[model samples]
Target: MTTLSPARALPSAAEVALARESSRTLSAYLQTRAETQQIEIVDDQGAAHPVRVPVSALRLLVDLLTEIGAGNAVSIIPIHAELTTQDAADVLNVSRPFLVQLLERGEMPFHKIGTHRRVRYQDVIAYKERIDVERNKVLDALAEQAQELKMGYE
Candidate 1:
């Protein structure tokens, strides 16, 4: 039920280049194998240590690296994590007041603890997905209408 902290700042130019290279190399290695792989890690003291990593974790790391390589900030939230209203609003890219309105309207489920409200991470994600689908549908309908009216839409 722990909440994740805010996303880190975007990767710097050097970090982005390193992430892109590392992601490419790791992705290629992953494609060749499905089992746990041993990778060497060098410490600041120049001592090399071999570590065994699960394929699943490596895949997740690759995804994270890819996003960082693209200069995007990233944060990981567990599906079952509970979030504060501000955290949920940040995830939805909406204001906290607007999110409270949605909670009051039951657009997404939430529960109150004492006086503060808490929302499930999965519920917030599901709500966002539903909103995105509806937005796409509306945009598609508008495009179709424009085409029918020959309003310079093809």
Candidate 2:
């Protein structure tokens, strides 16, 4: 079997099901729209006249509507304070290389200005919280196992 690379993302199993459902709803929506409700043409005011478009293109606009309704649009995280990825890594309590690995793996959000990547203070907080939560879960399990084995405690 052939596997797609990370860059060549086809929908995940869940997303594929959602897309199929979206297609059905889209087909229904197209059927219910009036001809005039389908599309509006626009023009640049300098000299050129407006252009015509097909109702088929209406699907493009509505697709974004669905994505927005589904909470799939990019979330705008406030960056009241910003730090370099290395600094954010420190805040995250991980090595700089590990933070870079997260960025490269698309697990972290950052913006590149020139060549430097900056992460928001809020993102740093959230990342730390996530790691701490997972760490605590593992530690809890380890404690339970230690109790069972009668080790590490008197």
How would you encode candidate 1's per-residue C-alpha lDDT over 57-128 as one tens digit per residue? 899999999999999888988889999999999999999999999999999999999999999999999999
Candidate-wise lDDT, in order: 0.93, 0.65
TM-score of 1: 0.95
Candidate 2 wrong stretches, greater than 4 Å: 1-79, 152-154
36-137 per-residue lDDT for model 2 (tens digits): 333234566555554444555657645654554454532222356777776677666789999999988877788888998878777778877887899999
Spell out the clash pairs found in candidate 1: none
For each candidate in turn, the TM-score is: 0.95, 0.45
lDDT of 2: 0.65
Assess the local accuracy of residue 59 in candidate 2 as a C-alpha lDDT between 0 and 100. 70
